[model samples]
Target chain A: MDIVIGVDIGGTKTKIGLVDQNGECLEQTFFRTQDFPNLTNYLDQIKITSDELIQKLGKEVNILGCGIGAPNASSKNGTIENASNLVWKESVPIIEKLKERMPMPMRIMNDASAAALGEMLFGGAKNMTDFIVITLGTGFGAGIVANGKLIDGYDGFAGELGHVDMTLGDGRLTGLGVRGGLEAYVSATGLKRTIMYMLSKYMVESRFRDVAYNDLHGEDITKAAEEGDEIALKAFDYTARVMGLALANFTAFTQPEAFILMGGLTNSGKWIMEPLERYFNANLLEVYKGKVKLMYSKMEGKTAAICGAAALIWEIQDKPS
Target chain B: MDIVIGVDIGGTKTKIGLVDQNGECLEQTFFRTQDFPNLTNYLDQIKITSDELIQKLGKEVNILGCGIGAPNASSKNGTIENASNLVWKESVPIIEKLKERMPMPMRIMNDASAAALGEMLFGGAKNMTDFIVITLGTGFGAGIVANGKLIDGYDGFAGELGHVDMTLGDGRLTGLGVRGGLEAYVSATGLKRTIMYMLSKYMVESRFRDVAYNDLHGEDITKAAEEGDEIALKAFDYTARVMGLALANFTAFTQPEAFILMGGLTNSGKWIMEPLERYFNANLLEVYKGKVKLMYSKMEGKTAAICGAAALIWEIQDKPS
Candidate 1:
């Protein structure tokens, strides 16, 4: 059976996996991308890992294609433009670079878009024709699907749901140039800020204050909320409200079939999903009230990224030029 | 060339026209719907007019089909359920009734969707595969085209752009029960309300104060604006700002090739169009900026609606059940 090698490149770690036509993963592996000195060495390690996975899965499983998902990846130009997270010094022609070592047709897309494609292919939204996949990790991101097709605007940068206006606070004068946006409230930084604001109001003691800036993760807050913490619940509720309002604004025009939520904060499960679902329904137009479903990804967290990356490549190849 | 009869049934009047494949109106006629005592008489008038037009055009132009466009047309059901404006109290099996007289294939569709199809076929958006047609008549309405096709959704009521929130005044609400929508400022009702609000504040007035609600039209306001009226200009600017923000919100998701503005008020031309175009460009997502074109429809006034209604019928016949 023909298979595709899917790669998910991040600042800290890089994940690789073999995906079949049915979106089933055969063998998956991971390595620290930061360990490599440069792009060449990093890609060499990836090739070695790919070879190992192929050997384990049997050499008869021909690698038909390769798909890579990364920050600032441009599907139109087939390049990975300089990303602040990655150590790369210059724009990298990812498709061309991968061709030299692997010798197969390849495609690369933004990680958020890949995640959306993954949700469409193997996640809870497998049967949905129109939906938006939102990633709430370090920063909020989204991939939009309309009329059963992925929307890549003139510049291949169509889905920017996070950047849409949501805030009405004094902190609008931040790094992001936009006036009001969803990213201001839903991202990891946004959650940290929310926690800090709450801390000033209440004399609370928690593990969050100790590792506040350096090593604190979004999951810690979710865990704290799971233990019946009020502050954490407030933060989650705030994020869900803004996300829901933004989704309502989006549904006004496209009216998608569903919204698929992912990323680290989504692990909060009902703490985040239930409120988000409620607010989204409340804000929806009467005709669209009971139409859109809110779903969470069922695939293992790691597999979702790679599967999404693979789906991006598959989708690009299938579309008419 | 084969010809088709395109019938546009409005609340107060009915227009019947013979349209060719090239979208040319070979022969046309109109009559006041109030003249007919009942739907039977109204339909008989249409039959008589159509037969006369067909006879005048001669046997050389064979009528191949018929298309109808109305307010509450259900493409799925091939009938126009009772429209609020129309006196018809029961569902009109329009196609089945009209078919007996014409002896040709017939189809029916809602007016807004038909307008979208008309724009796609012969208006300013002729060559584009993806775009939106915004009708700014008594009420604000829209028909969206994405991925080269109109979105019918699950219930065939997909493109409802007017009801989306605009967030102007807290008291303003959409037909869907949402507060602060585009229709609050962009439609004919919206413009009149805006003018009335301005009248309470501004001292300058020329002709609007004594005008009857029925006689108050967008053209009168446009004429005043052209004559250098301050209140008219302010009203246009305020309307433009609201429309611009709404357009920005829409382009954030479904980045259609263009937004074609139609209906009565769009005749205000540069007064409304210039400011709206300016604000749309200034506020759009940086990536989507300049990608979407704002243009007026080549079909203006009642003729466009007739054409749009006709196109709806043609579209229904072309689609498979």
Candidate 2:
């Protein structure tokens, strides 16, 4: 039996799992990422936890490699550069440090890209050679797959579709300080912004009217829209319009077979998907109409992150260098 | 010495050339495409012209394959589908017919995609694996190369950047009847539209003011801008702003090393290039800033088309199936 170590490094918690060739998480453990302010301590803890997980298995297993999903990670350089969410503000040579202890093949990519690989390896995009995996969480991120491989581009910074300008500087500014980006209109933060904007513009009766801006969650909006809240419905509609148009523009670039969406926003289900599909079809160029399908990620939540990270190893094994 | 048959099928004329592996045209011939109303006759002429060019070489040379660049061509199916510019409105099995007569390996791609392959094989993008070729002719077109391969997408209709919506339906209508597309604001037709719009909006004295809409040409706009005509310069400025911003959005999709510009609009020289570069840089996301270089295509005019078509064969030979 062969198993690979999968690591998902989040802003707060870090998950480490032993994933089998069948995309099954045999065992997993986690630690508070913020607990280790020092880089060396954090790496040491990861090693300790990984060793314990392997020891607990109590069965003979060939360790294949390790795959990590982190913020601002570069697969080309095997480093994380200036991740806003992580405690480390500088470039971290993660792959190098991990290899010293693990003594196995390893790969690292940003969480979104890892998820894309996961989708390709074990999710709905299993047979797709060309598609896009959109991560709609606190921010927008995408992993573009073409010719059955991820497009790392010249500097391994390809598929930053979230930052693609949407409003030409006229719309809301994103956390990155860029104005009118797709991230400013299509992410969780963007959804909240739209809700706030609509609340001010329209006098629709809604539970969100009393909720504070920072306190409001994406789930609250989804719940409200489900119960026929006008403001919440409008917000979803607005977000869908922006995303649909952007996806249409994206279609012109690659004409992928489908766009597989994941993350918090997708939980809104028909609220976002219905309008998004309608608008996407409406905006697509004539040649591409009714051709591209919109789909949801088969994997869910934390399980998705771990499986996606593990998928990195499986992906590399299949491709020739 | 190995040579390939290169064909550039244009709306008005068709150019056939015998090109050596070195990207040199040893012999060439032309015929008016409009003269052949039937697809069979048109394909037969191509075969006849190819044989004539090979015979004229006057020496024994290995004919490797044939590469074709035409409107709405599909390399996957070896056919041309519903090209608006061509008189034949139905799908034409061009490669199947041509191969029957010539009996050689053949490939067909849209002209813009062929140009991208050309750039990779023998032009500015020779050293760069990731780049884009933008054709700013009567209409806008792009050829996206990532990971050392053209992104033909699932249906072989990728890289239609011109049809990417720019205005969400509020802007000018493109000839394809789509409103607010990048084509409506950045092509040769778009430049003329800009001039016309500027002339109507402003009382600036210019050579274009006296010229009728149909009489006006893209070169005239370039010449006028060269002489520092206010309206002409402003028109170039307007066109560049739209194009620059659109390119910035495109940059986020695939962070290519450079964007190679070609066609009539590029003839505007610094009038378009200067402000265009400024806007492109200004609009780029922080991560992508100053990373993507803007360049002009090395090959020019009819020679470019022929060589680009020839490059397709060379490109395939370099890659293993």
Candidate 3:
């Protein structure tokens, strides 16, 4: 049996899995990323865990390659650059270090791009040649596909859609210290800010008024909206308006076939989708009106990230060299 | 000798040139586009004029194919769809009609896309794989190249940067009846509107106040700015500010190596360039701050369009199909 190792590196935890060609995860394990502060030790642990997974299979197996998805990873340089969330704050030469211990053809990309490739390979965008996979988690991120290929851009730093400025000078500041960026108004943190604003602006009764700002979470807002909270619904509407208008502008750039939503914020479901769909179409240019579809990612739960990482290997393998 | 027929179809006139592989025009001629309101007659005139140009060359030349650049033209469908400026109000099946008179491997694309291709084949972007060409004529248009290919989008209707919404709703109305689009702020007509707005808003003394809105042209503003007319200078400042900010947002999309400015408005020279450069760099995300260069088109004067159109044939011929 031939298999590939897929690694998904998060700030707090790291997931590793043995994924076969059919998009099945044969075995999986995780380790605390913060525990291994040193880069070399961290890579060594990945090798050890991957070997343990193969040994547990209890049969003859061939290791094809490895693929990794990480924050701020550059596919061109094969390094992770300025990933502030991680303990290893400097640029990590991940590919160079990993190759010495567990050698095979490997690739690394930003997590959002890996998820897009995952969507193209084994999810809702399987048949789509041109589409965008937007990951709306703690922050906003996008992976663009056009002409049936990922837009790696000149320096492999493309698809930084989160930081794209949404307003001239009068919006919230993003993590990058930029004001009025898309991420400032469209992410999980953005939703919380909106709820806070609504609480102050409107005299309408809402459960959110009782909760402290830092105590609130995206799930709490979603729950409140599910219970017909006015402030929560209004927050979703405001976020949807910003997202829809930004997407309409993005449509002018690539005119993609569809946009697939992914990550934690998508858990809000119809609260976000219904309004986003309506605003997206309403803001589009005349020619692109009613042509683009909006949908949710089909890759479900824990295995999705591992499968996305593994899809990177298949993508490279299938390319005409 | 081998050559291709390059046709540049404008609203009022059409230019035809016999071009060789080296991007040299061997012979050229023109015919009034509005002279014949009928589509068939216009295409017939094109074929006749092209034959006359080839005969004038006075040599045995192998005609490779014909390539056309026109407004609202689709390279995929080989038709001109809803080109309002042209007398033919309906979608014109240009390739199908031209094939009957002059048959060969032909291609057609919108004028901006053709100009970008021309820049790749013959101008400043010859060595660049990723770049954007912005045509600042009476309206704003753009052609984006990423991963060494044109971003034609899913339905071949990509690169409509002109209509990308620049404001939430506070800006001017565009020709498409949309409010606050990039075209409404960054174009020649947009400059006139800006001048008019400046005259009404500020008590600054200027020559522009004497000129009515209908009689104003882009060059008039440029000439006035050259003489240090405060209102005209302010108008250019306002236009440049809008364009620079828009380009900053655009940079986040593809991270192109450069942005080449073309068309009539670029003739404003330092009146636009100096301030545009300052604002563009200031507004760019930190990662892309100093990486992207802004340049003017290397293909100059009337011959630029003809060369751009001819480059299309070479582009198709060179592809590894």
How well is each residue in B1-321 modelled by candidate 1, as lDDT tens digits? 677788877655688888766667777889887788587788889899988888887767866677777765666667766454467754778778776766777767666677888887767767776777888775677777766677655445566666665541234664445677667678877888888778778888657777766677788899999998787898999888788867766665556788888876787889998999888887676556678888777875657777776676555556685
- lDDT string for model 3 (B32-70, tens) is 888989888888899899989988999999988998988
In candidate 3, the residue pairs with backbone N, CA or C atoms under 3 Å apart (3 or more residues apart, or in different chains) clash, namely: none
Candidate 2 lDDT tens digits, A9-108: 8765788999988788888889999999899999999999999999998888888899998866788899987665578876899999988877899999
* Candidate 2 Cα outliers beyond 4 Å, as residue runs: A10-15, A28-65, A82-106, A317-321, B11-14, B29-65, B82-92, B96-104, B316-321
- Against the native complex, each candidate's DockQ, computed on alpha carbons, is 0.25, 0.59, 0.58
What tier of docking accuracy does candidate 3 attain?
medium
- Please give the RMSD to the true structure for each candidate, in Å: 4.8, 3.3, 3.2
Candidate 1 residue lDDT tens string, A142-179: 77776677766545655665555443212342223555
Q: Which ten residues in a row have the lowest lDDT in candidate 1 chain A?
A: A167-176
Candidate number with the higher DockQ (1 or 2):
2
Interface RMSD of each: 3.8, 1.6, 1.5
After TM-score superposition, the amount by which residue B217's alpha carbon in candidate 3 deviates from its true location, in angstroms, is: 1.6
lDDT of 3: 0.84
